[model samples]
Target: MEFSNRTRTGTHDSHRTEHDATRPGPMEEAAAVMRCIVCGHRAGYNRAVVDLATGSEVGGLCVGCECTAFGVSLLFGFRLSGSNCAFCERDGHYAIPSWRARTVETGGKTVSTVEYDVTEVTVRLCDEHLERLKRVAAAHARVPGSVRPSGPE
Candidate 1:
């Protein structure tokens, strides 16, 4: 599903406030229809899906609040899960490949976008996790000169 740029409106887990400055806006309707990568559950009310970069809620299966969080943990290992570096946070994914390759439009003013490669890799993860990440990256590969996520004006 395509991501949405609109702010989210709904109740969330006690710890997850929709207004948190760190969380991105809510998932668009399209994203809400996606099945959880971890639990295979369709996103329902209050699922814990979030942007993989930050563990903030994006959208997830309504049946369980953990689908979004779990899916990201599986794709990108969590610090507390004791998962290996293959799934752990890394520096590569957070780097913007090149300076000329990014841009941003903020407050009606255009600016250079932040480029980062936040994925981490370690030796201990199983091959299955690595393969999963590769597939994920392949699917999300953006077109050259495509804007990174912030929507049109």
Candidate 2:
């Protein structure tokens, strides 16, 4: 999301007014950072949102909780506490990262660009929903032309 600030001046009193049209101000960001996603504890920057799958630099882990094994638990997948399942609102048991590539029309020809996007809000999924998503992803991968973008003719 983009944000811009607007300022207006009044001639009568020569007063300047400033207004911010963006949501989630600094206070909100700070509050979000303070809240722990795993144990619902307010430990400020001590807690992190860790990825259970690859154990990559997804986020942080709670210092108080027993989930301090950052990037060490591959067999038992776990996501941040506050994060819910993408498919369902249930507690997120696993964190999955999705990647895709596409072709864009540049000038008169189509150019393939490696577009990568990671979800800011972790995609937490329950066991049942995770299995379903895996199956769907597998099916799509098997289909030819499904993964590629339909560029300009």
Candidate 3:
């Protein structure tokens, strides 16, 4: 499931504003340092070589010489399929996708350079789990006009 920010109209000195000053930003983040798929180097993709999506600079081949060689052939939005359900080991009937903010550290462990990315995680679900998920989602969603829970087909 995806989440969107909600804004409420406010009056300041009888003037309307879209920016909410009272909204506090996240004070802490839960993150993990995942290595690039192309190279085992901790900070390889955008640091050692250019990112195909974003044209930075391909200075040279990465520590793992196979980065560009194999990376170039992969499609832009690649994902794994034919997997079991995320909740259980059953043939997946539907794809469930969620997105989150991610940061990739570059310039090696010595430097503090960072690149931002919106990472998407997709999981497959079996029919039984999917129905349960739908019911739970509907129950949790109190706002009207949201995706209503589906009935039996």
Q: Number of clashes in every candidate structure?
A: 21, 6, 0
Predicted candidate 3 versus true structure: per-residue lDDT over 9-124, tens digit per residue: 21222222456334321211111132322232243223222232333322322223222222432235444444556567786554423222343334331122223222233344
lDDT for model 3, please: 0.34
Window of ten residues with lowest summed lDDT in model 3: 2-11
RMSD of every prediction: 16.1, 19.5, 19.8
TM-score of each: 0.22, 0.29, 0.26
**Candidate 1 TM-score over all chains jointly:** 0.22
Better of 2 and 3 by TM-score: 2
Global lDDT of each model?
A: 0.33, 0.39, 0.34
Sort the candidates on TM-score, descending order. 2, 3, 1
Ranking by lDDT: 2, 3, 1
Candidate 2, residue 46: CA error in Å? 25
How do the residues 4-29 of candidate 2 rate in per-residue lDDT, one tens digit apiece?
11111111111223443244443335
Per lDDT, the best of the predicted structures is 2
